[model samples]
Target: MSNADTILVTGGLGYIGSHVVLELMEEGHSVVVFDNGSNASRDVIDSVSRLAAGKGRVDLFEGDITEPAQMDKVFQEYSAISTVIHCAGLKSVAESEREPDLYRAVNVTGTSHLLSAMERAGVKHFIFSSSATVYGNSAILPMLETAPLSPQSQYGKNKVEIEKNLHAWQKKNGGIVVVLRYFNPIGAHKSGLLGDRPKKEAANLLPAILETVSGKRPELTIYGGYNTPDGTGIRDYIHVVDLARGHLQALKYEPDNDGVYIFNLGLGKGYSTQQVVDAFIQETGLTIKQRRGQRREGDVDACYADNTRALQQLNWKPEYQLNDMLSHAWLSHKSSLM
Candidate 1:
């Protein structure tokens, strides 16, 4: 009953989490998925099963990290789950604003509950699903991991709070914890078996574009009148598959010299809203009807990443280009219709 090979992934059926689960299974690790079915379902299980090719072990436990009792029961049941890639928690910045308390309760408090369970269970390795929003509004073009911390939204603030708490906990806890601060994650699995077609209304850009093209929405609304080249916000969009591989690399990292390490997971390239639209049209040959809208609160003008650390430390780099991202994304979206 070695704990080293058993991994527990929260929110394992979400967009990014599902891909990571596939990678984990591909790498022959036993995975236990704990999700509340808030934003996911067993639908992804079918995809993972196919992607796994019966090479890895997997199980499911319907639980919430915020509920101590549920979390405790899960830990007791899957005592072999020593390493965790925690992907559960509310993700949308806009949703967080509409419900700040919900953000705090789930993102911050829920993480605390998970930490307690980890300590009690004596789990050693932890990989947190963090966002680039933790960088907030920095004037720096390619933000580094050491940039000043000034989170704008409740979602970003909640991540900062959780990071600070993890710092404190890492002092007493003797294990490796990798906090992956992700940039925009778009696209789908190359196989088109798993993709992000959320049950909720569109909150992300690529999904909005897909929905607009698919006629789910009348049109796509581009946010903000920014002072960028195209008067729209600039973001670093890493293909979801590339981002998924980062987690696998993080899990494989030795981290022998440090207790906690932070890495920015991105493609290290910035693309504006207009640029993305043009690229999408070029890649998919589909027109996205767009209307300009006022800038959403808590969003920065330009935010990319300095991915040097990830490449040097984890031997990870973006292998997919923007074209590859768009093509795969469109294919996945089309496959969903079949």
Candidate 2:
């Protein structure tokens, strides 16, 4: 956390990465945002800069993580980069199922390249943006950090493989590696300037809800046939702001020694699809035309998190509840329209 050392954030222009960049800047750490610009906009750099407000400097380096030379060049150019917060990867569940090879190449191999480049550049600390999909549909009530991984989708498999790679890399190189496995992340910055604006297809539930509310989609589809009370899938939806703050906490965490520390970033509570839709309608005072749809492949009936590890270890607790998440998301969505 030295003021002189810059934190390199991969995929810094993406939804989660951009928020993490903001948190880092607000913490008085200069950031080097390295993004491919494939699924992100150059405009995010400007928005982040404005939001940072003279706290810490922000710089963007456009490069593909799959390109070893480009990664090496960025690391070489920014010799002061001491830590890398990795958020780059293809993240669509349906898309991953269709293009498993593509997902593996980018999420797995691209990360391998990034790690090699970091090793070459002598950068030690690392923080990974992992997902709850790694846990799959475990029979356990609340998914624990120690639960056996049984990924249901190629996207989840990619995360599991990446986590393995991270552990191996840390064991070999010996450095601080924090893997933050996020559950269902929703909501947006209160200012409404920065939020999830996917360049490609929208896969997440909240985005689909937003689109339905705005008439971009005809109606919301609730995947049914689950064992929950409403027979709809349940997930632990955490606010994007709180998720970003968890990254900041990870960056600030001082470990006894270098090792791979795993923590689930979630609200530790489950909310069914029907409950979410109902809450959205309640919060926004908007009508959402919706229908029941068959459950998609790789989907679990109910999956939430046992976030006690994160709460005790990182001192990170979700500040926003379901109502706050829905309302803030609605506000950001409306502001985007304006």
Candidate 3:
């Protein structure tokens, strides 16, 4: 995609999407934001606009992705849109478990609507925001692109299902679709102008840690304490900005390599929960209370990313480390509290 090409980012006002929008504008690409405002706020658009220095307008459409007519309207207005970074969907695993129907409707059916709309509009270059949850509990320490698919939750199953549908679409139409299987994404934009603002309580570890530091919660609950060296859950936490850059790389991907090309976006290292808590406490010097608890249902003992495919194909590697992730997150959280 060229700097002049208009990129339509679905859910562009959300955590990752907002950052991706900022990155795209920094690269001189015009961005049109398509969000339903279901889980995002309008304040993000104002922040994005201010950050971009008004170089680009965050044209937003407030409508559900499941509505074909709404998506069609977006395509109609922005006919020159050659690329789409699909970041829109219901993402909570617990919520998906509670409402499998809602997950299916938004994730699976919503993706179908976007792809169908793209096909009708003759826009092919697609970047799908997938998750590492598709790997479930893998025996492989660091998951690879070829790892077996075993989703533990409805959210994971929904991502897998959408990936399959995208592959099918690519087969019929000669379109380049890059499915980015992201590991646990943490941290905020370095600017702190944009970050995750979950409508309800957060399920992610970093947010929970921030909440503990902010004193919103009484104590941090260490879910598991009998696994591996740390006796806590380990995850490959990639910075949100790095994950956003990976999407830009995916969009520029060529079409000769058609079908769904999967890349694991991560740092190739895992951090245990206790390790993360220690890092946050050490970095911020905050007295974060903690409690050990039994492992939650469907929680994995450990998981990280091989990340070789992304390095080789996209020439992308995480520039930040665990300390950097913690520090940045602490800074953002502290700023918000102030």
- Prediction RMSDs, each to the true structure: 1.3, 1.5, 2.0
Query: Model 2: per-residue lDDT, tens digit, 1-338?
Result: 23468999999999899999998988888899999988878888888889889888789999999999999999878889999999999999989999999999999999999999999998889999999999988999699999999999999999999999999999999999999999999999888888888888689988899988888899999899888888999999999999999999899899898999999999999999999999999887889999999988888888899999999999998899999888888887887789
lDDT for model 3 comes to 0.86
* Poorest stretch of ten by lDDT in candidate 1: 1-10
TM-score of each: 0.97, 0.98, 0.95
For lDDT, the strongest prediction is 2
> Which tens-of-lDDT digit does each residue in 312-337 have in candidate 3?
88888678887777787777666665
The collision pairs in model 3 are none
Candidate 3: Cα lDDT at 57: 58
Error of 2 at 124 (Å): 1.2
Query: How far is 229's C-alpha from truth in model 2 (Å)?
Result: 1.4
Q: Pairs clashing in candidate 1?
A: none
Better of 2 and 3 by lDDT: 2
Which 10-residue window in model 2 sums to the lowest lDDT? 1-10
Q: What is the C-alpha lDDT of each candidate?
A: 0.89, 0.92, 0.86
